[model samples]
Target: MSEQAGSPLEDLTAGGPAIDAFELLANETRLAILVTLWESYRPFAEDTTLQFSELRERVGTADSGQFNYHLDRLTDHFVDATDDGYRLSDAGLTVVRSVIAGTGIEERTLEPTTVDMDCKLCGSPAEIAYEDGWVYVFCTECDGLWTDRSDDERGQLARFSLHPAALADRTPEEIYAAAWLTTYQKLHSMIEGVCPTCSGPIERSVVVCEDHEDDGICGNCGRNGRGAARLSCAVCKEWVQSTLGSIAKYHPAVVGFCYRHGLELQYGVESLAQIERRLDEATSKVDLVSETPPRVDVTTEMDGDEIRVRLAEDLTVLEVSERTA
Candidate 1:
């Protein structure tokens, strides 16, 4: 196998000539071919083949010679030819799917609406809007934009429609709690090993909130808190955080236990108490020897599994392990 075929990451690495790959895809005919092949590869299907004549007809090009030339360009990198016919390579499928999704987001229009929040800086009305697949809350008076991108397209729309009046009967704290819950769901998905933004690997750590001295203010959101558990995408560096208590829900072991108990890990009287009890039990197993930069070595056993976790000063899970025995 060639060096390019040795590893998938090599295709886009700095060492690789990615510009050549991009240049090859910079043609309409080649893109059409990729799309055709991708569509033919149906879910749960055994075959993804399209005859050369069929592919030519689908692309709708008149000249066979020109079509062959364009097809040749993508042959080794994006397209594969077999005794049966032609199909998109793995890289081809990824590129075509990304292009289709991006085009959908760009072409889709969202109506802007005024939100109920007053600008913290100017005390004026704020507006919520969706653009380029991101949801934005902007203060018209202060021109402050707080942008959030959801894990999925549907969630993005739902977040934009979450007006204060939507939950008119709920209290202010309840509203904030609902919003926070949405944020936590996205955070949970990211910390569980997949980044919602780019589908990349995520790294979780515990950090002292800059406002730790002021009773745990989140430096990112300016919310008053004690400390935060931060999770950042390894590929995109998109970072998110929550209070230590909230972040604990991102733990795999905790999530598993919650799943087994038929418990929805949301912020509520019963849920919080359950989480606190579990955390306390996990904490009691730890032996702490340091205070300045707090460190704890702890173990927890749940659902026929044993987990050993080491925590940093800010309550980040520095290391974790599970044993079946």
Candidate 2:
């Protein structure tokens, strides 16, 4: 019925376009949970990995139950639980990186930025830039700004499916082949050397489930929230989720998969930096490879799953219906 003129939270949400992404961290507890990531980086830099138990310790709130509730909320926001501990989600990393740059909704809570580098998007070198809690990179060529609130690599992978380049110099059928192959690789990596439930030859792959509680049966699991944590294209780091994958797959690259009932693209990775490096190498020389029709089940690691057998498709697991020795 009524609104204020100078509400601080209002200014925060002034970024209506990015509202979905930041909504996760909007809560005070969730914001604190995200800050824990920065803590994880300093003490365990040598460990080179963030652990959930460590996060629990660093976040040491009064109520263990309440702390866990916040942790789960934050987990759903940007991290995932694995046997190894809670690892930062790609979105989680984007949030953390933004915090490091003194950007993002929570950046104001931290000290100002000191480190400097060329704008990742624009190429013009600069230092001390922050906005909307996102470390922004401006491109001299296009005046593009990839926010620290976002991850360029994460964005590109999301778009690569229909990305003209993803299907480049090839027929639509061939593009699907590359897309399928890419999907396979992603699933292979996440199955973790074998199925957690079964010792049989488990492979990572996409599946269709009409029984899902969310939007239109979804293309795959963990993809419904693409709108929340979208980042700039990994290679160009200019466009916002404009890779071929987003256009064709109708999903972010990190969350793509195959669904006869619907298409999927579950390409979400643990580390944006690692995925960025890999895709950069592939995209640079892919000018000619794009012309070739895609084959194999899962050669492109980032195409679908983590990194296991360099799988081409996890869907094959359904066909085999049994694990291998």
Candidate 1 lDDT over residue span 1-325, tens digit each: 4565557656556444566888898899998899889878986688888999999999999999999999999998999899999998878887877676556523543355565445443566655554544444555654232224434221111232232232435443344344445566667777577887678988876554332334232337443433346678888686675445445445676566555645445445223244334433332133443445765555555555555666776456777666765
Residue 148, candidate 2: Cα error in Å is: 25
Pick the TM-score winner. Answer: 1
Q: For residue 268, what is the lDDT in candidate 2?
A: 35
Query: For model 1, what is the error of residue 35's alpha carbon versus the real structure, in angstroms, after optimal superposition?
Result: 2.1
Candidate 2 deviant stretches above 4 angstroms: 1-20, 42-53, 102-325
**137-240 in candidate 2: lDDT tens per residue?**
23333323222223432211122222223422543333334544443343333233442222334323222223333442133333322122122222323222
Q: How many pairs of residues collide in each model?
A: 3, 51
Model 2 lDDT vs. the true structure?
Answer: 0.38
Tell me each candidate's RMSD, in Å, in order: 11.0, 18.2
lDDT value, residue 241 of candidate 2:
26
